[model samples]
Target: MIRVLIADDQELIRQSLSFVLDAQADITMVGTASNGREAIELVRKEKPDVVLMDIRMPEVDGVECTRLIKAAHPQIKVIILTTFDDDEYVFGALRYGASGYLLKGVSVSELANAVREVVRGGSIIMPGVASKALEMFARMARGSMQIAVDTQQTASLQENEWRVIREVGCGKSNKEIAAALCLSEGTVRNYLSSVLSKLDLRDRTQLAIWAVQTGVTADPYGDRT
Candidate 1:
């Protein structure tokens, strides 16, 4: 079963999420926390497969909590759930290695599916949130946001690896990329893993941001793009 922890300041929300998730046989509600501090403690103790995190909390916010969790236990996947989809928080969550961003208003089934997706080593964003996230990224590129990685380091990627990076920037899932490139999902996963290793990226979100920052997807259907 997919182990999950819910962290929300509102008791009602926590209870509601638990009620919805408990109905799924594939998922187990391992624990719940009322604040980021409690969530961090529970995370260290329980080591759940996925964490449904809230952005606002009393002791600590979700962004910092995510950073701590990933730094201490990179294996644990975090999905930021919040009512607000502010650009700073979205970018902050991704930068801190959150597996996904989701609105609390998303259906219970969608939330469960998102948790599964994150557990399976896939990144997800609520439908509308993703478009806005991409738009924020575009603005960052156009503005003065510094590219986080060393360009010289990424200069070693082969043509095919660059292609993989571009595809990731477009937010195509592994299965979609496989079908589009006429490759097996396993092959696509392998290629992406290799790309991440070579480029020293933490996750797909970083890879996608880097691709856009480098303008790798600017040219449609181009080899490097």
Candidate 2:
């Protein structure tokens, strides 16, 4: 089961989220917190697989909480939950190691799926948030492309690994890649692990950004495969 900790200041929001998430047989709500500090304490104790973080809260905010949580426990995935689409909060959370972001209005199914996706090392942005994220990415790309490219790391990827990187860059899930390549999901996951190791990437999101920055996404996955 996927263990989760819900961190939201509003009692109602916390309870509602817990109710929906707990109903999933594959998920368990291990704890809840009304603030970032409390959330941090709960996390250190529970060691949940995922954290549903609220952006705004009393005392420490979600951005700082995310930074702290990731610094100490890098294995726990954080998915920011917020009613606001504040670009500052979104960028800050991502920079600090949030794996996904979802608006409070998102469907229960979508929220649950986001948690699962992040746990699997895949990132998700709510449908409406995607366009904004893309815009932010485009703005960041201006500076990112100008930065020195690490060719040595680029040279380490094999042809099949490059294909896996491209699929991930296209936002295809592991199962989708497995189906398309006639490989098992475990095999696809192994390919991803190898790709990350060879490329010296932090995670799939970093890999996707590097792939786009390095202009590796221009080629089709089939050709690369």
Best by TM-score: 1
User: What TM-score, computed on C-alpha atoms, does each candidate reach?
Assistant: 0.85, 0.82
lDDT string for model 1 (1-225, tens) is 988999999999999999999899999998999999999999999999999988887898888999999999999999988665456776777777898788878887788888887776778866566567677667656667545777676777776677777777777777767777788877877887887887787887778877788788674652552
Cα-based lDDT at residue 9, candidate 1 = 95
The ten-residue window of minimal lDDT in model 1 covers 216-225
RMSD per model, one decimal: 2.6, 3.1
Q: What is the C-alpha lDDT of each candidate?
A: 0.80, 0.79
Which residue runs of candidate 2 sit more than 4 Å off their true CA positions? 143-149, 170-188, 218-225
Clashing residue pairs, backbone N/CA/C < 3 A, model 2: none
> What shift in Å separates residue 53 of candidate 2 from its native position after superposition?
0.8
Task: List model 2 lDDT by residue over 1-225, tens digit each.
Answer: 999999999999999999999999899999999999999999999999999999988888999999999999999999988765567776678767788688887788998888888888777776565666655444545554322337676676677788877666555667777877788878888888887777666676666666666566667662432
Residue pairs in candidate 1 whose N, alpha carbon or C atoms collide under 3 angstroms = none
Candidate 1 overall lDDT versus native: 0.80
Q: Supply the global lDDT for candidate 2.
A: 0.79
